[model samples]
Target chain A: MTPRVRVPETGYNFAYLDEATKRMIRRALLKAVAIPGYQVPFAAREMPMPYGWGTGGVQVTAAILGRNDVLKVIDQGSDDTTNAVSIRAFFARTAGVAVTTRTRDATVIQTRHRIPEAPLAEGQVLVYQVPIPEPLRFLEPRETETRQLHALAEYGPMHVKLYEDIARHGHIATTYAYPVEVAGRYVMDPSPTPKFDNPKMDDCPALQLFGAGREKRIYAVPPYTRVRSLDFEDHPFRVQHFDRPCALCGAGDVYLDEVLTDDAGGRMFVCSDTDHCEARREAGHRGEGA
Target chain B: MALARGFADPVHDAQGAFRAMLDALARPGLVQALPAALAPPAPLTSELAAIALALADADAPVWLDGPLAEAPEVEEFLRFHTGARLVADPAEAAFALVADPEACPDFSAFAQGSPAYPDRSTTLVLAVRHLAAGEGLAFEGPGIRGRVRLGVAPLPAGFAARWSANHALFPRGIDLLLAAPGRVAGLPRTARLLEA
Candidate 1:
């Protein structure tokens, strides 16, 4: 193992960013945390990587990362996914920090979507890569309009859109990128994570930071902060359910992704959270596939 | 000799300070301790020094008020270490250091930021005599679960009313970090000061 020192072995200044840049991001992060669910605009620097591909989360992680931290990166719930693998490798090379796929082992976890099934501890920091931080962007295209709306707390349009979804479909058809109200004040877009991962955000133990590099936005949900998915009495918010348990790990309660086995209708359910699945399997969890 | 020096371990110390400030600001009314306590010049505690080192950089302008401003060593230490430019006008400062809250300027005197960019507002790092929970003020907002009582002694008179008006500004208002010796507490614009 590389010595957990300030200087990275890769010759990059700690975490691949300069001290000034880190301080700037850290200041924004502090503000972001203070005003939970409010998107704080930051001077998003031009990182080595592109904007959409976890740059925001990477910047956030870089700013907060210490020499002793164990880092983890997951893309769409899978640690081995292409995006996840690259991000994990990037940090390993630049930060020279210990990298882990296990949720329990990681002190800082940067994820694209799907919160880990294993509950996060108090000190852990969860950095989320957000493509669009604005929850009202789709409804109100103009940034000025959205800013005003947020200031006035006029989230009636958001409710109207969801209400319309119910009117069009039998229920609120919005599944991914579901809007949630943080601290009963600011309506926040909890990234594009499956609505299944939405409930995990409520009163969570770990500090949650959302970063959008292209959007130059940073927001946070501090530990134990109240976060409620936007919904009404008539049309309550519900997570997606699978009839069958995970075919590999037998996780019935965990979020599952349905994968087609063949060209035919043959398919199988698997835990969306790969770390959770692997841990359960190692612990003697069994399923039909086993 | 310079009264206060920079962190012994720049990388590690700054990281630790950043994390502590992050935790403190994230959870308002909760007093988080600084990792390393260094005695700065008069009025400025080690906690505030640690914060300024962690947050301020060459790109940002910081304002010092009262005795903290009068102390040349504090300015020299910050300039030499963090490379932060000290500004005279509070409105131009990205960060403001206040040794005495009672002698501090009105909350509106600092940059409240524009409607488009709320993050542009100044963050006040004030030296306080007391930073604990008791009977002073009740805080309820994003960070606070139900309501958390915070007591900060020697706060300027009519601070509650001032804070209420500041809170009314919402997205465009100054955030505060109250530093007392090794402990620090934050009061964001969102935190509502409930009336007694």
Candidate 2:
């Protein structure tokens, strides 16, 4: 008698995406990597979740996730947030893959709004959930016009927008979703990550993949690629700095979030990255709250 | 000729190959190993066949070069496994398979996608006798950190000149995947060959 094959309880294909869909996404991913920062259009498939809830990142992770890969998902730098926990559970249930909150242990990380605080190695892949893949979308609005601009290497409008911000506020007021030039060829939006995380992207060892599901676009920044934030010679691009260290772990030089203690007008700033803060605390780091 | 087999476990195997291919392309000049289970016909290396199986599909039309085009069994194997359409014109192909890199056409002969959509161009998978790291051509570009050397034996004549022309077409040119016996290396259009 032949041996019986045990099927998954969910009855869904591995990673919840069919083989053909995975193939199509893989092809688009190759093209996206080939032409760094150039948005490649793909046939976006609807997922069980909503669009704003990182459908694009989920698809990219599903297509690239192998049986041995250790997956990690984060939203706004926190691993235990509702979005992050849901995504982690989704992959664990469907693909039956290992999930970790530690950045170093993860082989594939699906992120929204922020890159991890820890440095990524060469073998790791970073998938960003991008809401807008085009830097010129808000400026040009017309797809045809933006395509022409990108083809001609016309980035004057982007600079003008920054210049306008400088004219009004005496400095560039734009913070998140800063525009960057990839490999000195195409101007791209590095998702909604804050300008504070922009420097981390330059010469990053990990391969960075960006996906925008509603827009049906995918782009990439290959490992060690040049990603320069837009700035003028006199007024250079700068990252946000904190006046004090994290109240929870006493960590410095990391993005922080403000937390209100009570109605007694007391507030404390803590590390936005939960894993980083916890690791630091375990290593004997202490703060006022700790 | 007996029909060959594809991946033993199609889903996981293809995923593994795709990750390797992704790493190979993302880090240009780096050699990545493909799954060793595919038994393709002659003139098609296991690495190349693995890439085709992982990427090519009914929507992706493939163009086979002289050596591969002449082999009827190769076509049957690819069709049976990947179901990719075979096209004669290089410009119409989404992916091109080349067994003889020495006689392969210039990069201009293939589809250099328009400025609007550069990703629409063809990706060439060339089967070479040797792919390794030595005192070969140095590459510098997006994926490369400073510089890296890659030695691909039996490359086409005037390869530097041809690559220069191809690289000149920023965001609009053909990418290359050089497959040796068990490993493959990528040469995206962005990677520039530093003259010796």
Say which candidate scores most in lDDT: 2
Instruction: Kindly list the per-residue Cα lDDT of model 1 for residues A128-230, writing each as its tens digit.
Output: 9999999999999999899989877899999999999998998999999999999877899999999998999998989999999999999999888889999
Task: In angstroms, give how far residue A258 of model 1 lies from its true place.
Answer: 1.9
Clashes of 1: 0
* CA shift of A254, model 1, Å: 1.6
lDDT of 1 by residue, B1-196 (tens): 8346778888778998888788777777877887656766656677778888887887788999978888888888888777889999999998998877888899999999776577788999888888886557899877666788888977866899999999998777989888877777889898889988
DockQ of 2: 0.91
* TM-scores, chain B, all models: 0.94, 0.96
The 0-to-1 C-alpha lDDT of every candidate, in the order given, reads: 0.86, 0.90
Poorly placed runs, candidate 1 (over 4 Å): A1-7, A263-265, B1-4, B37-39, B133-137, B194-196
User: What DockQ was computed for model 1?
Assistant: 0.64
Clashing pairs in 1: none
State every prediction's TM-score relative to the real structure: 0.92, 0.97
